[model samples]
Target: MRLSEFSVPDTLAARGALALAEQYQSEAITAHALRSWVWAEAFALVDGITGIDHELLYVAAVLHDIGTVTEFDNHTLSYEHAGGHVAIALAAGAGWESERRERALEVIVRHNWPRVDPAIDAEGYLLEIATGLDISGARPDALPREFVRDVLDAYPRGALAAEFGACVVDQAERKPDTAARRLVDGGVLEKLAANPLEAR
Candidate 1:
């Protein structure tokens, strides 16, 4: 799809995603510098996911962290608390339907670690994996082997899921620290260990 097709018109989330992506690409920002950038990259992988409204997922991913800009000191809690307000404002500003707005808000709120429900299964799964991938940075040690295994087992043949996983691995490998590299390398090794029945 054309990038513009994914755009949420006149919304801060949309603008912020683009700006953060550009900043990262230019090396003008550290991974830490662009909290939204990491969120958007993870979101883009969600965009590549199928069996869902890619637009809605993309929009929700972008807006998920809007609360971070204001109350970054406790981002996770802040995001959980403030996500609805930010989502409501942005959705209304963008003229989104109430259903769509609510769905997006739900995704944003549940995007936290150790996700809350399996009912919104796909979105929740994506959010957990995406959040793990983003926080892990170019190399994430935070995600344990069991978590990766659980996610993989749950979505074994999903193309979008595999793509997202691969992106996390690849990005992690590109970091400067040997520790980060080791984490990525080790994570893959651990994944293989956990799922010996599966092919690499």
Candidate 2:
């Protein structure tokens, strides 16, 4: 999973989804989403996890945060659920079959709640772990240091803590009892402040 060779899907659905994501999200959020794909792919290689559809994960990674953006934000459900629907719709419009589209939705939704079982859904599990690594700075030792450095070089995580904190605070206001609220109440800011990546 070399960052040098990493590329977003070139298909219409992928392009459209990315365009929407870039339109709605701040630069930091968009960069974070792109970095998620790089981190997930690198992690997969480290764990020797194979059979992944990189293209599908690319789609999932880019649109996973649509719920956090203004246009798609839903007050009732968590951002993950809201964004999952948007991802599914994007996949549907791209002519993805039901099973594949549903899998993309599952990956987006599962990313919010950590620890998706790899056996059940490897892509979802990888996305979950990848986002966790980016957001919470969890498990710094999970991947090789050189790979992490290379990724940061390619996609510098500029002010990710502040960006993610703001997003979570918004979610806390829109929907309580969700993961965002837990993260806010659980001192995620302090955690973000303590992120080792920020030290770089």
lDDT of 2 by residue, 11-129 (tens): 97789778888889887888888889888887788778899987789889988887888889887888988888888898899898999988888899889774788888889988998
Q: Which ten residues in a row have the lowest lDDT in candidate 1?
A: 24-33
Clashing pairs in 1: 138-172
Q: Runs in model 2 with CA error above 4 Å? A: none
Across 1-200, the per-residue lDDT of candidate 1 in tens digits comes to 22223334455545644454333222221222133323333444544544655455555555554443333213223433354566566666767788877877677666654544444545655654564454433224333445434434533422323433443354345432422244355564445334332332
- Estimated TM-score per prediction? 0.44, 0.93
Which candidate has the top score in TM-score? 2
Among all windows of 10 consecutive residues in model 2, the one with the lowest summed lDDT is 1-10
The Cα error of candidate 1 at residue 178, in Å, is 33
Candidate 1 to native Cα RMSD, angstroms: 12.4
In lDDT terms, which candidate is top?
A: 2
